[model samples]
Target chain A: MIRLHLPQPLSAGAALVPSLDQSRYLTQVMRLKLGDAVLVFNGQDGEWRCVLSDILKKGVVLKAEAQVRPQTIGPDVHLLMAVVKKSAMEFAVEKATELGVRHIRPMLTARTQGHHLRLDRLDAIAIESAEQTGRMDLPVIDDPAKLADVLEGWDPGRRLMFCDETGGAPVVKALSALEDSGRPWAILIGPEGGFSPQERERLRALPFTTAVSLGPRVLRADTAAVAALTLWQAAVGDWER
Target chain B: MIRLHLPQPLSAGAALVPSLDQSRYLTQVMRLKLGDAVLVFNGQDGEWRCVLSDILKKGVVLKAEAQVRPQTIGPDVHLLMAVVKKSAMEFAVEKATELGVRHIRPMLTARTQGHHLRLDRLDAIAIESAEQTGRMDLPVIDDPAKLADVLEGWDPGRRLMFCDETGGAPVVKALSALEDSGRPWAILIGPEGGFSPQERERLRALPFTTAVSLGPRVLRADTAAVAALTLWQAAVGDWER
Candidate 1:
């Protein structure tokens, strides 16, 4: 069954209007006809089984038949990644969504290259990944912010898993030490050029930040995100279940 | 420091010549003058510090100064991934190299999309990733082979970690049980359409194969490769070192 992420509230027998793009996908691309069954969900509501009710000039309406699954969120893992190239940044967002990240915060560090990021495009990628990956909720993509500012407003209660390239304890060891903490966590990945001296010092000095190395190799920013997230999931997240 | 993957043996005071593309990257892209220092490595030999010795029209010559690091190989993990789309397949090769897979064998399955893969392109991607990620060696990219043939000729001593979409034991749990068995391993990732019913049944019935689920959500082939490799590394590979 095709899964669609609709923002509108859903309930049994509720008529929901899909977006223009989604309408084209359903009517033209997928060739789904009236009364065809489709799965739909909003971030707030659980997944629902719906049937195509009517076709309009601009869009189509879907009628929710029954709630198939209750809403559930994954671990509170935020990705504080530095802004990389456009392709790499987009790739990070898509993979993070599939890996069950809750939030993506693009950080602007001293070594980060200057580039304009289209938040709408990133949001679209996140939604598509979530829909395809059987995720019940979409990750919140935040606008790019300065790394200093993000750290300044950080919650001390949340442990920060900093992926340092220079040298640090291995990720498995670092995560093993935190196995009993049970605190919410976020992962920080630097840009291709890596973190500047000041940025590295600041991150290391933070009380809540724990520096962890992915391995001996220096992975690209996008690969680091996936590897770090995978380690987190295996060690502390829901992968144990 | 710039890193180059050279196939020639390296030693103190050994003179070497680079390929045409590498010369272009050094002269035009990086704008390096003669006598500039760069790091060079071959799969068999350790990394060496070298200096530009000569500049030709098509290639450049370098003189090795000393061995910087000794050759080291990662775990004996082979990736037997079904051939996916061109971009996704290339991405998997790159990430697998960065994540320290010793070998990559592209497999053809019933549900795999038909496409021509340029082995040269994949080798280049692997070399570039290894060069950038501090890897001492490059992974061998095998020609696409039938999944059945690969499985039939498989070594019974090596365990096969199968990422099954239908469901199985969680990855961490499955890997934990293999902690005592120090055998070589291979990971099998299916295509985007997933494994055929026959393929799934055959894989599950194999005694050497251990089916593992990444998580609750379904991951794209590329993400699955990264996540699966990361999990394996954390549980039993060199990350524990």
Candidate 2:
């Protein structure tokens, strides 16, 4: 069954008025007709079985039938990545959602080139990726902020996994050492030019920061994010469950 | 320094003439002049510093300098993946090279969509990735073969890590169990449509095959390839070193 991410509260017998965009996706793209079943999730009320109840010129309406799955979220893994090129940034967001990241924080570092990002565009990408990857919840994409400011008001309780391209302790070992801490974690990936010297020093000096190396060969910023998340999952995230 | 992948054996004091494409890239695109320094690597001879000795109309001549780094290869990890669509297949090849795959064997499964692949195109992607990722060696792309034929001649000494989208043992757990064995390893990732029932049965029943789960979510074929490679590296590949 096709899955859709509905933002409104879901309940049994509630009518879901999909937006024009979604209606075109369902009616025109997917060719779904009235009475066709689809799975719907509101990221709060869990997943529900729904059917197209009405089709109109402007949009389509769905009637929720029954709740299929209880609401659940993945581990508290937040991705704090430096703003990269447009295409790479989009790729990162899509893959992060599939890997079950709970939040995505785009940071502006000294070497970050582009500063502008359409939040709506990223939100759409996240929603589509979640729907396709069977994720019940969507990752919150925070507005882009300066890395220094974000770190200044940081919660010390949450561990920061800094992916240092200049080489550090192996990621598995660094993450394994934190296995007993039981703290929420975030991964920070630098830009293509990599973290500036001052930024690296500040991160390395922080008590909450654990600098981890992805591997011997240098990886592009996007690849580093994926590799780091995978290592984290295998070491201390939900993959162990 | 610009890096180029030269297939010929390289040695100090040898005059190296680049291909027309590489000459255009060096002279026209990069605007490199005679006497400009570049790094060249052939899978066998490690990396060497080369100086542009002559700039001709069609090609460029280079003089090999002292070796910069000794030849090194990543862990013996092969990738056996079903041929996917053109773009996704190219993406997989690029990522596999960045992840230090030693060999890539494209297989034709029952559900594989594309039957033909441009080996030269894939080789170019791999070379570019290897050059950018600071890898000394290049992965050999094998001719496409039927999965059954490839399995029939499989070496029992090498272990196969099958990334099954369906539920299976967690990848970390599955890989941890293989820590004691010092045998070579390869990863198998299916196409987007997944393996046919008969194909899955054959894989699952194999004594040397270990079915591993990436996570709970359904990952596209490209994502699965990257995640599996990351898991393998962290568990038993060079990342552990």
Candidate 3:
């Protein structure tokens, strides 16, 4: 069955038209004929079983049959990663999506070098990942913002898992010691050059932040994001059965 | 402060010669003159502080001043990952080395596609990752072998953590439930298309195998490797300080 993350509202008896790109992909690339089964899920609606109803010259229309799965959400975990190079940034976003993060915020640090970040490309990657990973909804990809500004407007209710490289407690020990409340959480990853001294000091002072080191060695930004998410999920998030 | 991974036996007051590639990198690229401090480490020896003693046309010679850090090893964890594409395979190796995996064995499965794997290239990646991540040792990259053969010759004492996508116990719960017997462990990650049914059955029947699911969604081969390592390290490996 072909799974797609569509933006249009999905219902039992509504018609949905795919985008031009999707239309060409379905007709020309995949050669999905009329009446072929296709699973579609809007971010707001549950996953729906649909079939190609009509194939037009420029597009294709789909008719929903039934909802195969209900709307579900994963644990509220966000990733705030300093943007690295183009390839690394995209790779991190895709991995974060697969790891079931709720949101992705591109962070800007003093040593951050990747300035040409695009929101649309990241959204596309998230959508593709969600479709492939069986995720019902897409993670909200926030715009790139300065780390200081993000910290200033932060909510105290959500604890932050700061992946500090210079010095910190071990990941397992620090997270195992934490008391799990029903609050949100986020993981912070710095750039390849790492955070400046001033930024590190400020982050260390945050009350909700729990600075934890991955291990004895240093990791690239993308790898750190994946490792941090894995540890956080296994410790407190949705990795438990 | 530059770090280099040298294969020669390192010791105090020993003159070491670098490869031609390293020679150009140190003299032409890095522009290191005589008496410049350089950190060198062999997989067997502790990290040594070396200084440029002689600049040769073919290679550079360095004198080991002192051992800056003692030789240390992380938890004995091996990664048995099926060969993925070129980029994903290399990325997984790099990440595994940074995560302190002791050895990496490329497993050939029914759906494995990347056949042009070079041992030397993978070794280079491991060495570079070790140098960059401040790791005291490099992971041993084993030759690629059929999954069945490797499992047939496997030692039953060392447990295998299989990342099964179909169904199994959750990662955290499953890993935390295991007894800490100080036995070596290995993580088994399937190919992009996943393990064959026969292979899966064989793995499940093994007495030492503990099949665990990452989450509801499926993950790529590289992502799965990192996640499994993170959880395993946290549960029983050396993540606790």
Candidates, ranked, TM-score: 2, 1, 3
Off by over 4 Å in 1: A180-182, B180-182
Q: Model 2: per-residue lDDT, tens digit, B1-241?
A: 8999997778989999889999999999999998899999999999999999998887999999889999998889899989988877898899889999999999999899865699999999999999998899999999999999999999988899998877678887678777833468999999888999899999999988999888777788888899999888877788767
Residue-level lDDT tens digits of model 1 in A60-89: 999999999999999999999899989999
TM-score for each of the candidates: 0.94, 0.96, 0.92
Q: Who wins the TM-score comparison?
A: 2
lDDT, each prediction:
0.91, 0.89, 0.89
Cα RMSDs of all predictions? 2.1, 1.7, 2.3
lDDT of 1 by residue, B1-241 (tens): 9999999989899999989989999989998898999999999889999999899876999999999999998889999989999999999999999999999999999999898999999999999999988899999999999999989998898999999988889787678777833579999999988999999999999999999988777899989999999888877787767
The candidate, 1 or 3, that scores higher on TM-score is 1
TM-score of chain B taken alone, every candidate? 0.97, 0.97, 0.97
> What is the C-alpha DockQ of each candidate?
0.69, 0.71, 0.63
